[model samples]
Target: MDVPVLETERLIMRSFRAEDFGPMSAFFADERSFYYGGPLSAGDAWRRLAAYAGHWVLNGYGEWALEEKESGAFVGFCGPWKPGDMPEPEIAWALLPEHYGKGFAFEAARRALRHVYETLNWPTVMSLIEPGNAASIRLAERLGATAERKMEIYGREAVVYRHLPPDLLKEQFA
Candidate 1:
């Protein structure tokens, strides 16, 4: 399935592209990528980038590459990802450090949750955050998620934050 594009007032969420490789590689290689299980080698980054594209092909729904609308910069990724038996479909986001302070993550995430809750009409969605990632935990809270529990995902212990349902999201954001 072709990836669909989503837009907010300041950002455009679209499919990953080959040109995204360099930035993606840099992102994965950076020490800041630690919370995300990154700091990957170039080859690992390539395979990971390939997986992002393949995810769309296999699932018909997955992460969207976030672009700044004004400059068309590749900021990061945000969308729904459910890698088989994941307990639940997860609304995820990862932005380069340069884009961190801006509201891009929140704006993009609001749209992503909308896609999952309203478009896909899923009842509940989650954000799996590493316990040590203070930034992401705060972001998840701002996105109206609450830490439901701690569980092992892919052999690593992480906190699972439950996002509000569509109706509640509407009321919260309205």
Candidate 2:
């Protein structure tokens, strides 16, 4: 699959590379990764990285590796995701704790949402956020998404936040 690269003012959203595993593994090993299905072993991290790549091959779209342009550092990932068990595709994001307060996730998510609506022609998108994950919930809200319902994902409870379509999002800024 050919993963298209995207860019924002401070980030280069591109395809995952083998070099990304180091930072990805570190993020997954930290407690901060709890909400993202982590505190995982290095092997698991590798598998997760491979899964993202595979998702692109099978689904035509998947998460992008977030790279900070200035320092060329790997920050996190954000994009459309839908595993077999998910009810629908969702705009998802995860960032290293060190990069948390910098607005990278929000920037990446907004761009990814636009890609879904504009490029992928998806009518709408949702974010399945874990209940206790206040930060992610806030980010979803910030992206003009509102809670639609609660559901279980792989046995864990998640709140489904539905995002406004591109037209509505444009009106919001207008």
Query: Candidate 1: which stretches are off by over 4 Å?
Result: none
Model 2 clash number: 0
Per-residue lDDT over 1-174 for candidate 1, one digit per residue giving the tens place of the 0 to 100 score? 789999999999999999999999999999999877799999999898888888889887899999999999999998988777688778888999988989899999999998887777789889999999998899999988999999998888899999998899999999
Candidates' C-alpha lDDT: 0.90, 0.94
Q: What lDDT score is found at residue 139 in candidate 1?
A: 92
How big is the positional error of residue 108 in model 1, measured in Å on the Cα after superposition?
0.6
Candidate 2 collision pairs: none
lDDT of 2 by residue, 15-76 (tens): 99999999999999999899889899999999999999899999999999999999999999
* TM-score versus the correct structure, for each prediction: 0.97, 0.98
Give the lowest summed-lDDT range of ten residues in model 1.
82-91
Question: By TM-score, who's the top model here?
Answer: 2
